[model samples]
Target chain A: MNIRQKVSLLLILLSIMLALLPLTANRSFSEKPSKLLAEVLGADVSVTVDEVAEFIVREDPDVRLIDLRPADVFIKEAIPGAVNVPYSEFIRSDPDTWISNREVRTIFYSTGNSEADYALVYARGMGYNNCYIMAGGITEWVRTVLDTKFSGGRITARENALFETRRRAGEMYTEYSSLPDSLKAKFLESKKFSAKKLDGGCE
Target chain B: MKFLRQYPFVLIVFLLMVVLVLFRSFGGNNFRYDAARWAESSVKGSNLLTVDQLSAMTGAVLVLNLGDEADLPGQLRPKTVIMRPESITGKENLRLIRKHRGPVILFSDDASTSARVWMILSEMGMRDVYILRDPGAVAE
Candidate 1:
């Protein structure tokens, strides 16, 4: 065969192979088998609002909150110290950078439960047993921690203690959210992430 | 350039096939867009009650506390009833809900619990069921 004929044959063969690649192995998109779904759903992979609140209040080093909300919402308001990894981005990107530490309790949250539930299931399906969902999402944090109130004549020491804790947490949430734009900007400026330059032995 | 001119059809077909393969492999499912759009618009506040609105409702409002008793707020308005979400299935709580002809406001320590409760009550065909917005911030 002439040079042009040989080149054309190679190109055609390569194109055909590429076109058939997706179909060669299992390719149909479907939810995991029922047993896998059951295992994920039945697992104790949920963290309560109170637990998350305590983590934020105490600034626990071992707890990491992952907000799965959109970037716009996250940029406007998010839990303090929480990182935004929107569900789409989480699904597309490598999670190692965000969730590599086995010791850190990575709690995923969205505006509500469903998105976080999906993220939890996805993570668990990928063998990430250390992942957890923040039950009820950020909305729950607002209602349970911020809007709590005592009423009627009933008063108990334990209840009082709980209320005080909620009160403190609520104040923290309010104080953070109510900060002036300039002050928040300054704080954000201080928190800006600067990439580290790598010094290596590459020659 | 000579090869392209001589084999335009083959080149175009090869490029198209390559593009298709790359897209099928790298382009994520449309499900991502649907899920994101669903999430962005899912938290509807149509049935939400703000502090001012609740205060204005006066006798018509019945606040149901669906969280732990320990975390009750410092001062809840009158006609407030405390009960776990599971307790809602009981005849007593159902009766209390039915007794209130006006709005039955659901609240918890967090918006998440209240939202879940709101969904349950909403699905139960209850009318005038509203969730309490966070008092610290204005209702969105």
Candidate 2:
């Protein structure tokens, strides 16, 4: 056979192999993986900070929020439920200190958007499909809630902040108004701080 | 010109594969050794402790290799905080270590932390110690 014919045949074979690759092993069932992965994992592959903050607002977000942040930032203002799961130790049998059964949605986040995203992708590659990335992460949440700017969009940032302030002024209202009265008191008292959901999607 | 200089592409590919295999093996060796040692134990003269047996050694060992978030029963309590070495460091660990008294099983997942809290705790006579120093498993 001519060299061109042989190379063309080889290319065709390679194309066929590549086409079947995903179907065989790479086939992933991540629900809306791109949008969700994109939402959590930014261009460089880290989850955003705002996503982490929203987690603090989750109804019962307590899936061990691991702060895969650098040591320096971790010291400054590590969120209440966050335990630093520094990325340096990739092979640490128990990567994170809080190993409460992977059953508990172990949502991961970081100070930067890309760091957490890479970890999430790596974890997903390692067969950990139950993990998630926090939306916007702590940075966004702090900016929206703490700094008071275009937050929920329904109300002005100042108005939203004022509402939280007024509510807290009356009494630390942790549990929402929709919750039972007894639970409201419990939440208000347990300002210990916690939330659930990985800002990212399940891989 | 580049192809000529970088000739023997197949050889290069084969070498890459070999390097990758070695790297992967090196990565998991430490944990594999620990698992092996544990498996070797519980075998007085003949019987060996399977992984199941070894894990069972850590009584009430809750394996979190499953779902996302779980709700523990109001009464459930974990006595031991088995953790990898690189979990935390410095002042952060100082605050955390003092909080949990249950023996913190430090599985040498990687290099030890420079956390003085861990050092102080080690010196303070807090024992329930099991340090598996496996050089092969460089969780780096």
- Highest DockQ, which number? 1
Q: What residue runs in model 2 are displaced by over 4 Å at the alpha carbon?
A: A1-61, A90-100, A149-203, B1-140
For B31-101, candidate 2 gives per-residue lDDT tens digits of: 11121122121112122112333333543332211112222222222532333332332345434554554
Q: Pick the candidate with the highest lDDT.
A: 1
TM-score of each: 0.49, 0.32
TM score of chain A per candidate: 0.73, 0.46
TM-score of chain B of each: 0.58, 0.28
> Candidate 1 at A177: error in angstroms?
1.3
* Model 2, span A44-63: residue lDDT tens: 33334444444444533545
> What are the lDDT scores of the predictions, listed in order?
0.64, 0.40
Candidate 1 lDDT, tens digit per residue, B1-140? 67555665656766777787666444432111112222222244366777777777755668887765543344454567887765564567767886788889887766555654453344334657887777345322
The alpha-carbon lDDT assigned to residue A51 of candidate 2 equals 41
Interface RMSD values for all candidates: 11.7, 16.5
Q: In candidate 1, which residue ranges exceed 4 Å CA deviation? A: A1-19, A23-35, A181-203, B1-140
